[model samples]
Target: MKLYTLKTEIDAVPVADDFIAIEAPRPDCPDGGIVARVIYLSLDPYVGSRLRGRHMGEAPPKPMEGAIPGAIVGQVVKSRAAGVSEGDFVHAMEGGWQEFAAIPAGHFRKLDPKSAPLRAHIGVLGMPGLTAWAGITQLAKVMAGDVVLIDAAAGAVGGTAGQIARIKGASKAVGIAGGPEKCRLVTETYGFDACIDYKAEGWQAALKEALPEGASVFFENVSAEMAMTALSVSQTYVRGVLCGLADAYQSSGPAPHALNAGAIIGKRAQLRGLVVYDFYSRWDEYAAEAAAWIRDGKLAFAEDHADGLDQAPALFAKLMRGANVGKPIITVSEEQA
Candidate 1:
């Protein structure tokens, strides 16, 4: 088997020193386990924190050792568990950037390739979709007349959150993205009521224009200026779902923002930090709803693809810098279907 592992300690944007590839022994399907051929690997900003040994709970990937962990979509080639079979399509959160992975059955979910594209299971139908659903539907509790604001609106979780807000009957769904193209996609393709181009001059004014009445729910992904901007225009009883701090992911030093504490205090706003893994048990519920949204053309998503496993390291660097328009995905192999 081929595996990509951390090559050395990294600071700033990850470079070649941050990753290396080597041959590894093929894994086995242990009791209650399934060995699958990796087909798609998802690159996310939080992975950078994990690489830097900042993630809690699990031991961080050791420099120049251990397989780099990630969410993956794959086809089962062997199974030692009940109700699982060879050639089954599956997805796992703790899988690595390896050609094949042997995961406990409890850690993997079977995917229906007939229902949607295999890779979609790891994109819109996977963790990103679930994150969007949890933050918008539960934490924010978006209502029909609510106005919603989403940061990083062109990215996977943000884009889906915007669309889901609209689907749940929000009066206005506004997005904040970095470029004209992403802004266009957020509004035109993803069906947000408006998208503010944060990279453009006077973006604050643009945000003001888009949310004339102020936003009631904030699906925050990028913190710092974007977060402060949203907090500034928040309405009474506003709910903010704190998901990712993409802006601070690669910063070498402190990335601080002057949040208007008065605004939150005066509005009685609620800001809740979310870690999607905590809500994994509800995956089936979100997957069902998201699948219907995609099937009905009510939701849309995009992927920025890197062709091979060797591209994982550079892909992470590019994604951290916001180079990708949507979810960053590495194609591990052709789907075995």
Candidate 2:
């Protein structure tokens, strides 16, 4: 099977092989073992961190663990289980970067694309959307009238997070993006109460004014600068969700500490690290709800399709550079519009 098997991380370079020969799944393996035909792929920043081996404390990925780093929607070519059958559209944890993948039944879930866009299985309707849901419901514990802040407002996770906050009850939802374009998208498109450009001068003050009442829930996507800024303007009993670190994902710089230790101590606020992996059990339920939200027009999602699997790596770089306004997705399908 062809896969991007990551051996190491080099700057501006991706370690991948188009056709790394490997054996197929065992003949005696479960009948549900199926041939996965790649469809849409999600290019995320976390994959870059995984390649750098930055998340060391977590369980490291073994060779048999799966593909290098990605999520994709695929069509089942062969299936043995009644739960899944040939022609079934499914999404997988490791996903098929190659043309085909022999995936076990358990790691894949059938999805109905007629209900939503097929590519959404890799974007808003997929893990990114679920990540936004679980992070807020499970981590933030959002309440009505609560002031919330989101970093990377135009991203797959943050964009959905901002929309979810507004729908749920947040009286004030502030989104922080890289520049004015995304800033406009945050407020005009995703419906945030305010949008701040982190690159702007006096951005900290802008954020403080945006959240005049102080942020109760800070959905942190960029850790270095934005994380610190959110903490500085956080409410006394604030909740900071450490969802992503776009700022410190690459370098080995000393991570910025959250605003003030005294505030967390004195105000009794909590800061929680959120790795969407931990909430696997709730994914199906989360996806169902999030998809419903989208169908109902409560949650709006935008995407940045970079086109083709070959362009996936470059799109990842673009995402890190904040060039994409939404989830950067690449498709294996030859049809490009």
Q: Which is the leading candidate under lDDT?
A: 1
lDDT of each: 0.84, 0.73
Off by over 4 Å in 1: 256-260
Note each model's CA RMSD in angstroms: 1.6, 3.7
Q: TM-score, each model?
A: 0.95, 0.86
Q: Residue-wise lDDT of candidate 1 within 82-118, one digit each (tens)?
A: 9988988889998888999989869999887777777
- Residue 307, model 2: lDDT of 64
lDDT per residue as tens, model 2, 1-337: 3454434334332333311323444223246677667777777777656655565453334453345567878877778767777778888877644556667667777887667777877878777887888778888988788888999888888988988887888888899888998988888879998899988999888878887788889998877456667777888878988888776664445666445666467756788888787887787787777778878988887888766666765666676566788778788763221
Q: What is the lDDT of residue 242 in candidate 1?
A: 84
Candidate 2 displacement at residue 177 in angstroms: 0.8
**Which parts of model 2 are misplaced by more than 4 Å?**
1-31, 56-67, 252-260, 334-337
As a TM-score, model 1 comes out at: 0.95
